[model samples]
Target: MQIIVRAYEQSCAGVLVDEVTVEADVSKTGQQSTFSVALNTPDEDGDGYVAILGNGKGGTDCNDNKNQRGALMSPGNLEVCDTIDNNCNQQIDEGLDKKWYLDEDGDGVPRGPDFISRCSKPEGNYMEYPDGQQFDCRDTGADAAKMFPGNSEVCDGIDNDCNAVVDDGFPTLGETCNAECGGVRVCAADGLSVVCSQEPGRYYHPDRDGDGQGASGSLPTLKCGTEPADPGTVSNDDDCDDADPATCEGLAEVCDAIDNNCDGVVDNATPACGGTLKNVASHYVNLGGDDWKTVSVAANGSVWVAGHDGKLALRRPGAQKFESFSHYNSAPQAPTDGSPVLNNNNCGDHDWNVSWVNANGVVFLGGQTGWIGIHTGAANFTCVPGQMPTSQDAITGMIGFETGGVTTIYVGDTSGRLTRWRPSAPFAEQFTVVNNSDFAYYGLHALSPDFVLAVGNSVTGSVQKFVSYDIDSQNPVTPPTEHVANPNNISGNVRSVWMGSATSACAVGDNAAVWRWDGGTGWSKVVGPTGVTGRFSGVVMRNDTQTQLIGQCYIVGGDGTSRAKVHRLTPYGWAKPLDIQSATANVALNDLAITPTGEIWIAGEDGRVFHYPEP
Candidate 1:
């Protein structure tokens, strides 16, 4: 360890100004101390003044007893040593020899006889004369009496004791004064009691609250009603129910409108109708008792049911019963059993697939005879001016489009041929084959306008493919582009495809197979519940975040039946399908639609048209 000391003031001759290194060597017998010195200045020759630099002592030989006292000399006065009592008064080097003053009783004054000697041994102990005489010094106890008389002993130049002089020196013994004046003092022999002069206008707490009454004297006294009372023990008599402090005066009483406490209000004062799952109405429409095959909702919220009997019956929203229209009757008729033909001159003797264009309230039905039927909030149906392909290859799917004042219909036949029908042109000019390829049985279900997605057993193998045509192209008779293709082994005959948002779409197929499309990320398979296997019949995108796939399954019964199931697409993944109750265990869902308010409309086999409100 290295220690360094710096001095601010210069010392007299023989004072050292050097750096020294002290080292200690320890051995078995003892430790030897050695110091290496470096001197900064030299001593003058023949001047009796030697430089003490590099020397621990002030140039005094350590072996000389005469020079031992020189080691105690003050740095400034090199000639005088503070170790001897030069001006003796029985104490060695007293007075200024110590840095501090002697305050025997801590009276802020030097209890002196001003002896010129060294400080007392053991430090902090003071030497005093027997007579209690003191050296009068500035700011010391000597000056305290001369500057302030009859005042309390403050460090300021004022003696508050009033002993006919300021700070008449501190008392020799601990004493108590009757007043601030240094008179009528009571001395304690053991030097314990001490009472200084009382401050002016401030008494010794004669009475409580300092009212100066009740045993009012120099001593302190307690007054009545001054001390705080025990809690809850007050004489005010203002609180009636002291136990419950809040139920005091000025509290109002609350009524019985769900307000338990009398706070003048009710609990949950306002109520709102929270959106919750209400009742779901599922009904099956029987078409002329012909074992109702399918149900669908038209654009104008009219419920239509078609079955093997070839009768098309309709029911509007909130209607109690269904109504049937004659082949081309201008007026709607009551529910009948006859094979009601559509307004379009097409014979009504076949199972039909139906889709609605809500914008114009048009109902497009395709089955044995493909036709475009119109119902503008009226009971009558008018046919558009074009005839479909032929009865041999019935229209399996039809999509209507009216963009930029050009109305056209895209029809997909069972032979996987997509045809465009423009009503205003001649028969030969109106029907044009868009895509007539080897894609077999492609039209079980179609998506929309320009996109005709088909899934069935192809000549090559069981394949799922989508053909998209640009309707605005000048050559509208050209083949569509095949954008998606799934190997038959992986995707076994996709039966239903539902597109939502432009990005989220789902295709379901046989064996509980489901595939999801997320725009740029093509398609990925989705896992289904274990042991549940069947093909999906209808798929509808309810919203951007939810999709519903309906199909038949053998999960519940050993035998296969048309079972309706709904699945919701969440952030994590697609949820398991929840079964929707159907009138019959084997009711096959054919089509699904979601109203503007998110109500789910399902058209299924056996005229099962069910309406499920959004959950």
Candidate 2:
């Protein structure tokens, strides 16, 4: 109820100082029940409020005692948070109390203001918070238990603490670090650093070669799901050569001196390109009258040469001179190169007529009387021993292949005998009949063991004969296919033949005899320059394992008496190299071979060995 106390503010204790009339709530309990507004002049309770008694219109003091010492319960004091009404209001602690909602999650935090008003905690006396501390961010559902003050920051896509920030502690989270992978910097598991999930399946690496694999030890830099978000990344890491696209995992190793298949082996499948270029024009001249008839090259750059009647020579790798191994030479001569030639008189030197060196640096030799042997840098030659047919002439030519300890060789002779010889086989299976009266083979070669090409003139040197034998045939009497034509036949006998590939070959002979064979057709006769005539006995094609000699065909031979030269048998015709013609003015070069190191060794008459060093 409103109270109108007719008193002045300065003298409300006993006597009125000035005339005034005020109205306030004076209907408090024990508010001067029998006193009137005038009789309320007694300063009971000693508070500034006068009890509104009797009529209760002017009773303002809620408590007044006989001793007049009332202090807390009166209209003159401010309301406080006690059970008693301090301001003489009927309600207890009315204006100064608070309304507390329930912290149902019991995180010591409340949600909204829908609560019970009380001076103390109403239901549960949880810890008290200061003003403005009751608005919990998440005080209801499953997350309400943690939506309290000072909550630990976590990574559940929400703010657990009441800090006004979601997922706190990760200060830079949701920020763009490696934005290309994604737009958010995720909180790492350890909470020590941030992470971008799109980067590196920790498997998506850089594929610099565009191969399906990346370089070894490559860093992961892409996210992989469908096609990689980064186009240069791959799911694998098996690329040994990051710069070469063809040098990835599962590739067939090529002859490029690299681990093309990523198998930790470099060029293990194909042989590497070899041959040191001899840009300088100089040859060694040592033996006086030794003639070299055959030239064979090995992978280690060794040059093997043989001739009629046990003539043999060898130019070891890095040697500048040929070692004449023939016992026919009157005396062994010293070489001009600083390196010495070790004369290994293998098997006491018989009539070694032909030579062939496989890729493994194994040398096979053919000799007169149908003798065959092998020299593998051993102390002695391993000769296949057995008495052959008395009609077996000299071993004119031979070509062989080796796999492990096994060897397959085709040995040809001037007696028109082509025999199939294998390791430990004394008597070989003869592939051709003994036609000593008709056919005499000279040079022999094979692209593979399946096909063998033997070129020669007739028994009387009247006509050229080109024959290819199929060694794959089970019949030892397999018929020889003659690459022959009747009308425009090549006149000069084909002395030697070299096949560049199964499809291309060149046969060289005396009197400017030259013929090129195309697999599509038969051999075609070729003529040389008219005035400068020479016997072209050796033919070789260049192969670097990358490009094919740029279409260059080198034919080495010379006029029988003098005028040694190197002639180029081009697609058009033959052209003589005058510089080589002048280098060996009188000597006649007989055979030439290109070693694995790309060195071109030319064996000539008089033990004169000219070299075109690997370029």
The candidate that achieves the highest TM-score relative to the unseen native structure: 2
Q: How many clashing pairs does model 2 include?
A: 22
Please provide, for model 1 over 310-399, each residue's C-alpha lDDT reduced to its tens digit, 9 standing for 90 to 100. 445555565644554324223334334432323433334454554445444445555544543433435444433234653246465566
RMSD to native, candidate 2: 16.1
> Could you tally the backbone clashes for each prediction?
28, 22
Tell me model 1's lDDT, rounded to 2 decimals.
Answer: 0.44
Question: What is the lDDT, from 0 to 100, of the residue 250 in candidate 2?
Answer: 86
Q: What is the lDDT of every predicted structure here?
A: 0.44, 0.62
Error of 1 at 557 (Å): 14
Q: 426-529, model 2: which lDDT tens digit per residue?
A: 54543333223357778887777778788887777468888887655345456678777332455666777777777887777777777778763477777555
Worst 10 residues of 2 by lDDT: 275-284
Model 2 residue 194 distance off true place after TM-score fit, in angstroms:
85
